[model samples]
Target: MKSQCKSVVTIIVGAMFLFAGMGFCQEGSEGKGGSAEWTKVIDSKVSEKIGDKGLVNFEEGYIEAVGIGAPPEQFYGKPQARPMALRAAQVDAYRNLLETVQGVQIDSATTVKDFVVESDVINAKVSGLVKGAAVMNKTYLSDGTVEVTVRMPLSGLAKAVIPQAIADDKKTDMKEHKPVPFSKKPAPADEVYTGLVIDARGFQARPAISPKIFDENGAEVYGTLIVKREYAIQQGISGYARDLTSAQSNPRVTDNPITVKAISAEGVGKTDFKISNEDAKNIRAAKQNLTFLQKCRVMIVLD
Candidate 1:
């Protein structure tokens, strides 16, 4: 009787950590749209990192985790059991979300977990934030398990993790560089360049919380250095996509984005990009670029 009275929430949560420790493989969608056929795919289609613990949807700007639990044998048929099972699932969901956010890449070199581990203050704050994550959905499974989904906004999580004056970082001198045109076009350089889209595909670039862009001469072109902490925390340092069309079409960048090609992926983590001096100059030259870049209006197309 005592064995049957044990609550599944506590037991299931404990058992679930075993899986977290082992870690599951990253789950990604199959059949990406190549440039030739990008229009056919939905504009809303974007990259997602799914794992056994939870998922981070880059397009939708949220991290989600699903927690599962079941009522104990003794309480299975009682009215109080439903709430008990739901509570267990909710607890389990928060735990899963913690693991998911921890895995988020902060830069080419570190992850959110790495940052939090280095500071007990930040660790506590992030934990508290995750606890308050919204309960997006709750469902009673056909097989008896109760599942709950909790969602955490990326913007909110980033605000806490960004830390210090790093968000105020901008160390580039746009005036020093000579203008190198990306192409011969009717649009003048002074025209309204609403945003920037870096076609970084095939360079093996990966997304991060913040990433820097450099010219061939190793001068910084874009990133935290130019973007304000407020905007970076709002829409992230930059958005990412699997196709050029989707990336440019995104409202984040708006219309008429200055498109450029990346020369190579920089940094050991491949989170930063190096563009040709010519393309880099074009990105820096526009008078309107400053306003948009400040708001973090940029996108990267990845393979």
Candidate 2:
């Protein structure tokens, strides 16, 4: 009877090891579409971060977090240890994603956290979205630890939050904010432009969900006021890239695009751009290109 009991204990320990090995096999491709999709969008020019909070990759159109976890004491001596650790890791990922998301800029003046704090409805919706973020990758360490990476689309977050920021009266006003028609060009009608690009490299401009562009004189050049609400909620107010080449090549601004220089970064978040009056007038006058602005086909190049 003593020998039989010892054999049973040995079999249970072996099974736990086997299960832990299986968890290790899931590394780099454990969930959703795996880490490939995220990696595809990355390049040497862009930066990546991982820690208590994750990162917001505007170029990739998403925010992501990496969660670390270990087996609970109760799971010792059982085959379920690794799985419990994975669950804990997922919970950690969710919390980290929430923190990273709350830090995302909604505009120069506010963040997602501000909206959440002001409205219970927004808080609940944001929490739901966090739960819905995709688990992109998972890894199991030989020392019996686990890590999970999760991602959430920036567009999804904007769609859920932007509506709440706009009032019915404001929506009516936005409808009337149409592009002005101008005939003179800043330089020349050099190209039949399909989109607009703002080179704000030295201005220290940053990304935002609803950033705007203004002329030196303070006239609005681009923002939610001139954008179609549906488009704004889908593609975001604009696209951001690290360099001019990337910004011009971005799908957000295809074909021949009109590139303008930003004289200053406006507002506290540095999301709003102040372009020369000549550039602003040229953009508004490029009637053929104004159509793209309405569709949110704009890109901003930042350092």
Candidate 3:
């Protein structure tokens, strides 16, 4: 009887050990599975934050940028660290975009003091424009860093800068004028065009609220009032391209295309260009078919 009791006790102890070991193995497997799933989720989030290059959408005039941030000492062990870091990253991204758009070069002869003053003004304008920027993506990394991406639409940039540009133009002595109405003569029987394309390559062209196309004699052939104010506010002054395909990609393509060339550009504070006489005549002739190019689906190729 004693031997049987001892055998029964030994069996019970061995069974308990086996069950405990099984429970531990199951727990370990579940822990590893959960960790693997979390890693995958993080990777997906990072990929989303770093969107594809095609996200730029140049046709729609959208620009994108990325920024990164990490926890700061002031927020050490605090919940606010993440939020603070994120805000910092966003500000950094905006600065980056400002640098990109503020490519306007100051004159070399300008004194350091003058450059500083001008730079301050430029910085203020850029900051105001960037405030309306859109936040596209945000992510938190395993290393306690935060990443962000911001986008600015050219249309939105135009809306913000156009009014200021117009104001600047007003400060100048350059008077706003209207395009000469084409002689109300009958159209040439052979004339056919879809829209205007300016070969502005090899010349410096910049965005303007009231871009003008001038003749060789410095006479304005097209000016601000010619383009609808609503259109400028919506579509911007002009769409730029490096080639015909890029030009057509713009939302402003037309069927009857009239092409021109920019011979030279003037003005340091603003961009003004003169077209060749041949191109000027083409523009004048185009005025006869103004209905097609009314929105100035004009494309200026740049170097």
- Which candidate has the top score in lDDT? 2
Q: Cα lDDT of model 1 overall?
A: 0.68
Ranking by lDDT: 2, 1, 3
TM-score order of candidates, best first? 2, 1, 3
lDDT of 2 by residue, 87-148 (tens): 76766666677777878888788888888777667776777677667777787777788887
Error of 3 at 78 (Å): 7.6
With a 3 Å backbone cut-off (N, CA, C), the pairs that clash in candidate 2 are: none
**Cα lDDT of model 2 overall?**
0.71
Instruction: Highest TM-score: give the candidate number.
Output: 2
Worst 10 residues of 1 by lDDT: 25-34
The clash count of every prediction, one per candidate, is 2, 0, 7
Please report how far candidate 3 places residue 62 from its true position, in Å: 2.7
lDDT of 3 by residue, 1-303 (tens): 345333333543343333321211121132211112323433322111123221222233655555566768877668988666666655555544444333322211221123224444533444455554565666666666665555666565556455545444445425543355654554576776656666655654443334666777665655453455566677766666656656655446565466666788755633566787666666666445555445656665554
Tens-digit lDDT string for candidate 1 (100-203)? 88787777777777766666666666776776666666666666667766677877777887643253232233444222333333346457688999888887
lDDT (0-100) at residue 254 of candidate 2?
86
